[model samples]
Target chain A: MFPALLHDALTVGAVLFVLGLVGILTRRNLIVMFLSAELMLQGISVSLVAWSRYHGDFGGQALVVFVLTVAACEAAVALVFVLQAFSRTGRLDAAAWQSLRDAEVPRRIDRELPATDAAPPVWPQLTPAGVRPRRDETAEPEREHV
Target chain B: MIAALLPTGTTPLLAAAVASGTVSLWLLLPQAPGSDWLGHRRGALGLVLGVAALAALAWAGRRLGGLGDEAVFQIVSLVAIVGGAATVVTRSPVYSAIWFALALAGVAGVLLVLGAQFLGVATIVVYAGAILVMFLFVLMLAQPSGLAPYDRVSNEPLLAAIAGGVLLALLTTSIGRLSADPPACCTIPSRADAVATAPVGPAAADALAADPLARLGRELFGRHLLAVEAAGLLLLVALVGAIAVVSRGEVAEATRKGAS
Candidate 1:
């Protein structure tokens, strides 16, 4: 027989689902948004399992297997999309993709996006270790800037 | 509406507790002003208020029905709720991802408590093991440069919290209503009817009531055979799609050189 915790289980699942919803709504980072979507999936899985136990049926458990499959595919496709977007934009912010919208829609802001706080990629500087490099005065005074 | 949902005796106290708690959470979560999380006065007050709401909800639940799987439910649900909220509120994406795994572990605990042995274990294996790993992998590659600008600020915390609170209240209240007045859909069979309708053959009933995991396998493979095959096809397609997507960058580069 199903125990009396049925409502409690549902409530907990709902709570988690709502919190995940808030995460998705409030966060702008694409990866975090995807994680929040996964959170929502977890919430639904919890509810399905609870209902399965209540009915003394294994159908819900079987269904969750499908859910897992879908979630996996979703993650794969979504990550690929993020990678592609990052290659073009060089950042993970969702706002960067506003260009994808229809031309009729007004832009939110005309100004350039604020410079990201993330430090630019650092490359190792190869300096001559043994001796001072001789500058060729004849080579147009070797410009100071690259 | 709150009064209509809960019993008359606990209604006022419950409403006050829930209201104050929502307010506290609203203030506690990082707002536009961005108060210091560790030492802020409102943050501490929000924590207390949130705990008070949890206590009130538990009390109401206990009063309505005897705690089923009492200890396990209490501990796991508490942990799940706390971990979930933390996942939502944490500023750092990696920390949020880690907290999400913790929340997922807690949800898996709930699934176990509900007698879903396979579902619980699978959730852990699939989510914590595979999905979280993929998330972390993408997160790392995407953010090779530390925290991004978007991670530092939330889009709309207050509005999201209000929406979340409203949805939570609606869901919990519906749960309470359903508990007090169960819908006609789920009618449990009486012992006499169960025995009378039971399979006459000993093996039949035994097989039906065999180990849950074994029964789950039978149900999946036997009843849902087509769905299972379809799922397999879907997985294969996804694998191919992922491979194609990842390789497109190189293919495009090669094509560009040929054209030039």
Candidate 2:
């Protein structure tokens, strides 16, 4: 009966591991991938504890403690990196951000600046001479209000 | 009151029965309609199957002489299986985390049954206390809106079948091996007895209880003094690292403003 119980636990662990693997393979969302990674960790922990119990030993249990410590550290660092990535790129899609190529910042910045030929003329020819064009009263707000 | 129903001679039998019942209940709970794939009907079927499994395990344990190492092991294993399955099947991350904690506790129970006090305590403290809390934090941070309709994975049936088949084969082989070579002992003192006799807890109450906090004080300043100090230092380091990571951008912003 106890063997059956251990068997069932091992089975559950294996199922979780497979689910996590498939999720990592198919999911495009980074957060989902992260969640999948957690599932994998959980699966391993379950299996380790089961083995420890089967053998009547404490080593496996002690190892699980270290695994937990490492997992916490990993989650903290990964989340911070994820936040930074999201801030840098509005779109979360990995494929869309291909243009952010490494070592091409100079060319990318030059492309962003407006072309001289396409710039709007500062002084229009249709404006009356000598009398400066009346500033659009509605366009400029009352500066004194500040 | 319920304990009275279980005769002294049959205490092991009752415990075994309860353990089995809990395991099956856990297995069947996930198949409930709450999950997207296993519809209400299938979920109901799974529940029925789970109940049946629990009953079967309990009956087997009772017939084989209720008080034995094997009986205890099976009970603990049943707990771990049920908890693990619940953890995976539940959609809510918090629920899953709770299930995982239960699973860890069950594992610790197994250690205690095996007469490994230090291991059991360590498992409870580290896995249940620290790891599960971290899992909860991650789950809360990555909040998934419940509005989205549930979609079962494409190859779920195939994957499940393969995994089930493999597990069945492994179990069969292991069970065959175990049955061929039975252990020598049949009945042993329960874990509670071992704990009572152990030097750590209440047994030391008379000497240390005089100073209410003496046990902890001794641990901190005695044999484990260095380890306690190291743990404190480690926590301090982790705190500093977290602060640095969170405030990097704010510090940069402040510096830029100062320069301006």
Candidate 3:
């Protein structure tokens, strides 16, 4: 019975850890990543508590108190960052900021370059008389300067 | 005191039976929709099941001559695992947090059973009251979308299989090793009799009678003072860090507006 209980705890902990890992790996959204990290933290806390019980020591349980505190602190910081990012760009899609990978550049070169060229790209010229330029078309000139 | 408590054998058996019955009931209850409020039928059913499970486990422990430290540990671990899994699998974040709190409470119960009264109480105070409430707060404020059934179906099975396989391997190996050379006798003490002997009026007094708080205080203040202090400082740092993080978004937005 003892073994069975221990096995269950370990299984749950392992699942949480794995879920967190997958979330971190596959999830592009920053908020989801933060949540996944919380999952991993939870996994470790449960494991620690289990070990403490198995050994008849309070240390493991005590450590969990600190871990919870840390998790709370982490969530606060991460969410703030997420909110800030969201405000800057209306969308939360992670891929939207692919251009931010470069430290010096504020805009994506691939997106902004064609219009700022000595001549606008042929694609725009090919548009029918009534067609309007896309939203990204306006930023092309600034992109080429960088 | 130990001698006075040791004579009663049936009490432990009764406790064990009750605890086991409660656990079984919890497992057997029909899955409730996660959106139901605590007052709803499903919520009531879950609560009833939880209580039954806890009662059964507690009774089982008492009946078994009070669960040994290791047994208590395992029981708590099982509770936590079940509760945690429920939290993750549930469709509603609110329900998930509730289950998470249950798991935390179960961990505290284990600590108490193991004679780590201070740790157990602290676990409940910090985890159930502070940590889980914070999770609930975030869930409310953020309002992340409810977990879609397809999402759960797609991910849970694979995760469950991997976790189960690993756990099975570990448990099988450990059991094999232990069986090769079983221990002679129980090393852990049973507290059921002591607990049962206490007067039923005040819970705190009853707890103190079993294990005085002074001993724990001495241990904390004497040898573990440094560690305790460190933990305290860590908590302070975390609190400050959380505040900073949560407010940073607003700060950044302000700065951006000012710049513009």
lDDT per residue for candidate 2 within A1-146, as digits (tens), equals: 24444444454455445445544443334444555566566567666655655543334455555555566666666665555455445322333354765775433121121222124557846756596666666676884364
Cα lDDT tens digits for candidate 3, A43-124? 6765665555554444555566567666655665556555556666754445557775778755522221121212433564
Off by over 4 Å in 2: A1-65, A78-146, B1-39, B53-74, B144-147, B150-158, B171-260
Per-residue accuracy of model 3 over B153-237 as CA lDDT, tens digit each: 2222334434433443353334323323434574343233344565655643343344545645654566678877876777678
lDDT of 2 by residue, B1-260 (tens): 21232244333443443343333333333221334555445546655665564555445434434323366666665676566555554444566568767766766775555444554676688667765675566546544543111212222333443444344335433432343343457423323334446667554434313442343345345655575565556656766776687689567757888999
> What's the best-to-worst order under TM-score?
1, 3, 2
How displaced is residue A24 in candidate 2, in Å?
Answer: 8.3
List ranges where model 3 is wrong by over 4 Å.
Answer: A1-65, A68-146, B1-79, B144-160, B175-212, B258-260
Query: Model 1: how far is B61 from its true place, Å?
Result: 2.0
- Which wins on DockQ, candidate 2 or candidate 3? 3
| Greater-TM-score candidate between 2 and 3 | 3
**Model 1: share of real contacts kept:** 0.70
CAPRI-style docking class of model 1 based on DockQ: acceptable
Query: What TM-score would chain A of each candidate receive against the reference chain A?
Result: 0.69, 0.62, 0.63
